[model samples]
Target: AAAVGATKQELTLSIAIVSLFSLLFLLAEPYAAMGLGLSDDVAGAWIGGTVDLTGGVVAGAAVVSARCEEVAAIIKMTQNSALGVYILLIAVLASRSGLGGKDAASPAPPAKGEGLVYGLWKKFPKFVLGYLFCSVVASSLADRERGIAVPLLGGVARWWFAIGFSGLGFSTSFRSLREQLDGPNVLVHY
Candidate 1:
């Protein structure tokens, strides 16, 4: 968001719109797939890829079956883990290509091989690091050694994920939302 100079509200609105179909897709896909005589794995994978939110994908898959939940969770996590790489690539390209606007608060380019690391580090999104770290810790902690703590950990993770997803709704501006003015802005997120 910083690299592109997007405000928190803009980011939230974009994400919320993109994920607006998640709930509907989740509720319909499982039964629809079964009615079509599709396999659980195929249905689960479709739901996971189609649903933008990780927590929603997992929970919705569980409603179908354990196998479906496992497949959906795997696909969703893989997609989530790809986020850091995607953002990093965008950062690198944006920095090198001068994509930002004139008002963008970009740092001065360093001399070749001088402060390059620091420059990249400055451009890097720190949230991606934290996100990846939390994912790793959560998976690592999901071992059999956790015993009774597993359910607690799962609940906490779900709660955190739900709160994170809700940032979209909470950050939305009522003015724009109520006025329904922003078809162009909405298309830009695509």
Candidate 2:
């Protein structure tokens, strides 16, 4: 009975962790996509309709570009959901399998905090890869003629946003945030 209870608890925790991470991931995708899409649209409109207002057009373009960066940051943050899920899944599985179970008399938690650092480091590669991809896409789009790049970038951005927003719909909750802030550790921070 105890084992069954423990298993059920672990499974519930696992699902919660997965759902949260997935939600974060979903939010980020749309944020990035919308930024990209808006950038493309604004740039197109300014360039096409404001031939006489060169200064205004340039200013608008610059603003749009900054929006892209903001979106990219949001997207990167959302992507961090993957790491969150991985960590939680590992923890739950390890505990449930008796690898770190109290009954198994497992040794004390590591003193070095190596696991946390290593896990973060493992995620660095993906972050770096994402940055590289963004850089390549940005450069390619910038160098090409506006007509050639706008449609493609716009489409890609739309897809990213749609997927992210859909995921967010499934995962976000004001109640979860309220509960998190009620925790002892959060109180200590205040």
Which candidate should be chosen as best, given TM-score against the real structure? 1
- Report clash pairs, candidate 1: none
lDDT of 1 by residue, 1-190 (tens): 5455455555555666666667678778877877887678997898888887777898888878889889999999888879888887777776675443333344444446755465566667786887777567656774665655667767887787779767656767767653554454554554
Provide the lowest-lDDT 10-residue window in model 2. 1-10
Q: Model 1 Cα displacement at 118 (Å)? A: 3.5
Evaluate model 2: give its TM-score.
Answer: 0.31
Question: For every candidate structure, what is the RMSD over all alpha carbons to the true structure, in angstroms?
Answer: 4.2, 14.4
* TM-scores, each model vs. reference: 0.71, 0.31
Cα displacement (Å) at residue 69, model 1: 1.5
In candidate 2, list every pair of residues with a backbone clash: 30-161
Prediction-by-prediction clash tally = 0, 1
